[model samples]
Target: MKAIIAKSNIGGVITTPPSKSYTIRALLAAALASGQSRIFNPLVADDTEAAAEVLTQLGAGIKRQTDCWEVTGGNLAPPSSPHQKLNCRQSAATLRFLAPICAALQGTSCITFAPGLARRPMTPLFDIFQQLGVRSELTENSLNIHGTGGQFKSNEVSLPGNISSQFISGILMATPLASEGLTIHLTTPAESKNYLRMTIDCLQRFGINVEYDDNLEEFRVEHQAYQPTDYIVEGDWSSASYFLGMGALSGPVTVTGLNADSFQADRFMLNCLRRMGAEVIINGDSVTVNSSPLRKTDTGLNEAIDLLPSVACLAGVSAGESVITGLDRARLKESDRVTAVADNLKQMGIKVIEESDRLTITGGTPRGAVIDSFDDHRIAMAFAMLAAICGDTVIEGAECVNKTYPDFWEDFQKVGGKVSINE
Candidate 1:
C-alpha cells in the first residue's frame, strides 16, 4: 500500500501502542512457566504473532482473546512431525530469543526464517551454542539445532556485546533452564544496554533473577524455574516518536498512556525534542508538544538506534546541520536505515551528508517528493511526518507499518493528518 500526504495541521490525543519488545518478552516468559499466564494489553501485531506461533509449535498452548492472551507453558517439546519447523517470519527478536530456548529442549529442532531475517548476523549466538556443547547447523534460510535437553555441557559462555542485545537476552532467558548456573562475559561494552535491562526486568516478573556488574559487561544467571503470573505490557515510546515529531513540526499534539520513567531507550525522544527547542509539557502519563522553530542538535544514537529515521527527519527541518553518530549497527536493522534516511531526505530537497557511522543533515525548507520506505515500518512512519510538513509526499510500501504499529495510518488520520491510501 502507498500513502499520499498533503501539507496540513495535526494535533490531538492518541494513545501509544503497547510495546512490542515487552509483549514478546512477556510471551516467552509466560510460555516458560508451568501454569497458565495472562498477558494484558499486548501488541497484537505481525511480529508478536510470529513469536506466539513459534511458542505454540514448541508445545506451549496459547489462546488468544480480545483483550488478553492466556499461555500455558513449561512443557516444551519439539514438534512431533519431522516436517514441522518453527518459522520466525522476518522477526529477528523471535528467532534470537527462541533459538537458545530451543537448544535446551531434548529433541532436534528446525527453525526457518524469512529472506530479510536471513541477512541478519547470527554468528555470535551460534558461536555461544558451540561453547555450551549444543550442536547447531546454519544455512541461508534455515537452522538445524540439536539440544542438550536442559543439561548443557558447559556453563560459562562469552560473546561480543556490541553486535545485538538480543543475543545477550537470548542467553539470559535460556540459561535459567540449564542444569547448572551460567556466567556470561561480554567482550566489549554493550550498546543498547537498556534492552538487556528490559530483558532482566521481564524475567524478574516471572520469578527469575539475573545479576550484573556496573558496566553491564558480565551477567550471572542461576538455574531456576519461572513462576507464572499476570504480565501487563507498557505503552511503546518508540511508536510515539513519530507523533511527537509531528507535533514538533506542526502543532500541539499529546500522546498518552506512556510511563515517564520507562527503561525503554526511546523515551529519550522527549529529551531530543526539548534539545531542539520544541515546547514540551508532561502531565503525569501524557506528554504534549507544541510546534516550535527547531534548531539542529548533534547527538549519538548508539543506545536508541531505532530512532534514526524519525530523528533524521526532525533534523531535516531544523535550522543548522545535525550530526548523529554511532549508527554503524543501524545498517543491520530491517533495512539500511542510515542509507534509507539519507536517500529519503535527499529526495525531499534537503542537504544530507552520509557516512558509515554518522549522518549530517542540514535543515531547510523541505519540498515534497516520492519516498521509498524500503518496506521498513520505521522508515515509512518517520517519512509520514515529513510528508505532513511538505504536501504531495507519497510513501511507497506504507503497509509495512503493520509490522509494529498496525493502526499508524488510522491514528495519523485521527490527529488531523491529510492522507489518502492507495491500496
Candidate 2:
C-alpha cells in the first residue's frame, strides 16, 4: 500500500486510541485468572488480536463485544497434539509472553510466528528456559516446547537487560504459576524500564504483585494466583505521537482520552515536544499542541525507544541540529529504524548524521520525496506526519500502520491531512 500526502495545515480534536501494550497485558493477565474478567476499551489492532488468538488456542474462553471482551481463564490446556500450533502472527509480545506461560503448563505446544518476528532475538528467553528445566526445540520460525507441568526447576535466572523489555515482562507474568518464587537479575543496566512498570501495573490490577529495586536491575515475584478483575485500557501515547508532531509542525491539535499519569514510555512525547519549544497544554484528559517554531533539542531515547522515528522527523525541520542518543536498541525493532529514519530524511533533502547509538539531524526546509516505510508501523506513521508538512510525499507500505493503528490514515484525514491511498 502507498499513501501520497499533500502539504496542509491540520487542526482538530482526536480521541487517542487504546494502548496496545496495556490491552495485551490485560488480556494475558485475564487469561491467567481463575474466573471471568472484563476488559473495557481494549485495542482492536493486529498485535492485540494476535495475543487474543494465541490465548484462545491455549484453551481460554474469550467473548468479543462492541466495547468489552469477557475472558474466562485459569484452565489452560496444552496443545491437543504436537501438530496443534499456537500462531502469534507478527506480534513479538504474544510470542514472548506466551512462550514462558506455555512452558509452565502440561503437554506440548508449538508456538509459531511470521518471518518478521522469527528474526527477533529469543535466545535470552531460551537460555533462561534451560535453567528452569523447560525442554524446548527451536526451528527457524517455530518453538516446540515441553512444559514442566506447571513447575520450574530453578527460581533464579539472569539475562541482559538492553535487548528487549518483553523478555523481563514475559518472565514476570509466568513466575506466578511457578512452584516457587523467582528472582531475575540483569547483567547490564536496564533500558525501557517504563514497560516493566506498565507490566507490573497490569499484573497488580489482576491481583499479582512484583517488586524491583530503584535501578530496575533485579525483580522479585512471589507465587500467587491471578484474580479476575475488570480492566480498562488507557489511551495510547505512542499512536498519538504522529498527530502531536503534526500539531507542532502545522496548527493547534487536541487529543483526548490520554492518562496524565501513565507508565507508558511514549508518554514522554509531551516532555520531548516541550523541550523542542512546542506549546503544549494539558486540560484534564486532553492535551493540545500548537504550531510553533521549534528549536534544536538534544534528547535520549533510552527510556522511550519507540519515539525515535517521530523525534527524528521533528528534528529534521527544527531550527538547528538535534541530537538523539541511546538508539542502539532501536535497530532491533520491526526494522532497522535508525537507518530507515536517516534514509528517509536524506531523501527529503535533510542533513542527517547516523551512528550506532545516535543520530544528528540538521533542521532544514524538507522537500517531498518517496519514503520507504520498511514495513514498520512507526516508520510509516512518523513519515506520514512529515509528509503533511513536506507535501507530495509518498509512503510505501502505508498499510503497515495496521500493526498498531488501523485507522491512522483515517485519523490523518480527520485532522485535515490531504492524502490519497493506493492499494
Specify the highest-lDDT model's number: 1
In TM-score terms, candidate 2 sits at: 0.98
For model 2, the superposed segments whose C-alpha errors exceed 4 Å read none
Per-residue lDDT value at 202 in model 2: 94
Give the distance in Å from residue 314's predicted Cα in candidate 1 to where it truly belongs.
0.3
Off-target runs (Cα >4 Å) in candidate 1 are: none
Clashing pairs in 1: none
1-423 per-residue lDDT for model 1 (tens digits): 889999978999899999999999999999999999999999989999999999999988999989899999998988988799999998999999999998988889999999998888988878989899899888889998888887888889998888889989998999898889799999999999999989999999999989999999999999999999999999999999999999999978999989999989999899899999999999999999999999999989999999999899999999999999999989999999999999999999999999999999999998999999999999999999999988989999999999999999999998989999999
C-alpha lDDT of all candidate models, in order: 0.93, 0.92
RMSD of 1: 0.8
Estimate the overall C-alpha local distance difference test score of candidate 1.
Answer: 0.93
| Model 2 score (lDDT) | 0.92
